[model samples]
Target: MTSPGGAAGTRTDPTGTPHPDPTWGPLYRAGAWSALLFVLLVLVPVVLVVVAPLPPTRGAALLEYIAQHRVVYLTELVSFVGLAVPAMVVFAAVAVALKGVDQSIAAIGGLFGVASEVIALALGSSPQSLHGGLVVLSNAYRAADATDRPALASAAEALIAATNAVSWAGILTAAAILLLSLPMRRASFFGPVLSTLGVLAGAAGIVSEALRPVIGSGYMLYGLLLPIWFAIVGWKLLHVSTARAS
Candidate 1:
């Protein structure tokens, strides 16, 4: 039997396994590159943190650290918040590629993914780290008088607390990954191993975000798994795009 693309030689075979329309080659290629970028963005902050551990979450200490390590702080901030950019692209491409497997699920997952990215971008922080307004607060704290410093410090602390607090953005992100993985498991293109990893990563991500206050460093489990999964997915997408092109 011929595939939906109306060509016997297209990626989809007689068994009815779904494949993306070859017309989506450009988007797939962009997504492939975005996936790699996402992985790099995830890794950079992790490595930076390991090399120069973040300051205590305390307002005064955090402010001082930001002042002293402005470069490092900004780099980490850019990496952390910038994640949404590539993530959005990857999610879009994945949604299009996987739509053939399950249209409704793919669309839902894509919306969740995009929503999470938007939230993260707006908030400018993640469950693991907080940076958004601290730099400006730090400068103000440094320039203020002794009495005024206290208020600025207090404000900074509030920002820190808010940033570290449990967030729906993280939860939605986990859900997106999980939802997308469901279709992936049934789709021949993604296969079982990748889908399994996605399921695990998504589940772990939700749990980590939910229990971050109690688990502390344990959140690293999800953090570590995420990049690994993205890296593999990115490589696969790259191959798919190349094959379609040729």
Candidate 2:
């Protein structure tokens, strides 16, 4: 059958739906795998946190907790920070896939998604996690004299406060997802269900992040919805790739 673009050698599925352009095969595959990877990375820290709750936010308690639970602490750090890596790929792929529906919105969404990942990775810590700088301070706090201990502890507290403060990275991420969902609603491949989920997840993320200071732990809603959305998106993308391959 002829492609919509009247191109030669265009493959069609059993139901006569034309396969996506072969040029996009690699990107689809990459996005599929990365989306799954993002889910795994997110789950690791979440499970670890449930198994071993994070230490108190106080500088002294936090330092001691990290010292005692070094392995768990470090694992969480790796997982939370690593999320940005796969997320960037997924965002790029989704943007390209939906660009046909609305190029301007797609570009804006992709930009927000990319910028969020870059900012998060650059920060090297999330609101609930400690920065790498605090790890160094923890070691120093342990080794310092009594007088020095207070100063070091104070410094650690300052770092924690700064890291936990609300930032634009998360807001942009939510905006990206919300904007992308708008285009997805117009794309047959994504359809209404995925688009609806994206809208919920994005709205939840925005509300949770924005009100986190006032509504502690409410952000869990966004956290839970995000992985679910990613999982579905990943599976769908994989299906698309497999169809193309067949």
Candidate 3:
């Protein structure tokens, strides 16, 4: 990898594309702005879930608004438009300029991440398993204070756990594109690096309490660290795009 700056940073492939760009002024500017946009796209919900207190009144109503208002859909739509589309355009332009580069892998990583993330999110919501991990834990506590039987409670807890596990895996996959971008040593490196650590922590956490899952906090802890990473990544990528245009 090139040093942060200076002589060694000049290393480039045999064909002679400068590692830092002969004129990095524009590229660095682009990287900064792109990262900012990424941060905003990712931070809205995280702040709601984190810095802000749980609405306590979370219920079907919230879910209903999420659906009817189409908040998630709109948010995703904007990102797809203003963020992803722009990124692909830049990827193509850069690849053409480099001449010897293949754009396939980067494209695939982004596409696969979209697919896996969607699948994971869907699976987490599916009600197919009545006796899954999440339900089990919820019912367990309920049973302790109420009349629910062990079998029913156990089933629910398992479903809850399974969903939690699957969700984390999906998140890791969704973040895969960001993580894989690491090898590129792109202008936006902070987001992927931090997100990768979160993935590891999440996967390791689920593995830890597989047998006698207590009121767990492993996943909670892991989720806590992601918001900042998102902010920085979005901003960097947005800025990078702008820089390239200039």
Candidate 4:
């Protein structure tokens, strides 16, 4: 059942050593199911971040979005648990077939990211980072009203710093593992370069979050890099796995 491409799956590395593919390989990306999930992973946060930058004339909308965040994040939790969580288990079920390096590492990344995400959520952004910085930013009206209370703003900024630190730890660890496994030719290629970007982005985000007074977008944006890159890696993995399978 080996594919025609000389079994890149079985092909030895430059050192002439064979690396076996995983049992189940990459998931069959039939439609855009994986892509949709990827979008969901990235898009929800994007929406949340966008909403944050918006004025609070839309308090109702912001609240709605927060509610939506619960839904999306909860869904994310379930999916990660159901689909992504047990990836590490070396089970004997009919699963985990043909899992190559790409699938293996990408799966690891997803699970890592998800675990971190859930943790960050459990802590609550405000409690971790600036208290209600997101809320304040999202509601321009609130921000405008609170302009006189610089102390609240400082407290909020402090909160952002704290929360983002935790968030970045997860992301940075995940990125390191995923990217290092890629073994790409160039440093700028998608899979190979993504981890680097993830590391830098995650670091920058942490720094920015920690030093709110210095003023830089912290976790506010570090997240943006992982989803798009990691998502694409997830999608690309199937193709790679499929090609190997064929």
lDDT of 2 by residue, 148-179 (tens): 98888888889888878786888888988989
TM-score between model 3 and native: 0.41
Candidate 4 segments exceeding 4 Å error = 1-22, 26-36, 45-118, 121-199, 202-215, 218-221
Better of 1 and 3 by lDDT: 1
RMSD of 1: 2.6
Best by lDDT: 1
> TM-score per candidate, in order?
0.93, 0.90, 0.41, 0.45
The local lDDT score (0 to 100) that residue 244 gets in candidate 2 is 40
lDDT of 4 by residue, 1-246 (tens): 332342344434554333334333434332124544645644654465456443222233433343435454343334433332222221111012222334454455445545554554444442122223445443443445555445444544454455444344354334433443343212122244644554555465545544544454445464465455445545544554455422
Cα-based lDDT for every prediction: 0.83, 0.81, 0.39, 0.41
Least well predicted 10-residue stretch by lDDT in candidate 2: 2-11
The local lDDT score (0 to 100) that residue 218 gets in candidate 4 is 48
lDDT (Cα, tens digit) per residue for candidate 1, span 1-246: 325643333356567776766678888889999999999988888788889966778899888898898888888889989989998988888888787777788899999999999998988886544676899999998898898998998998888888888888888888899889888987776788999999999999999888777888898899888888888878878877887432
Task: Summarize candidate 3's per-residue lDDT along 4-102 as a digit string, tens digits.
Answer: 332433334454433433344344444455545544544554444465333211222222233343444344334433443333333232222222122
Higher-TM-score candidate of 1 and 4: 1
Better of 1 and 2 by lDDT: 1
Query: Residue 18: error of model 3 in Å?
Result: 7.1
Residue 169 C-alpha lDDT in model 2: 87
> What clash pairs does model 1 have?
none
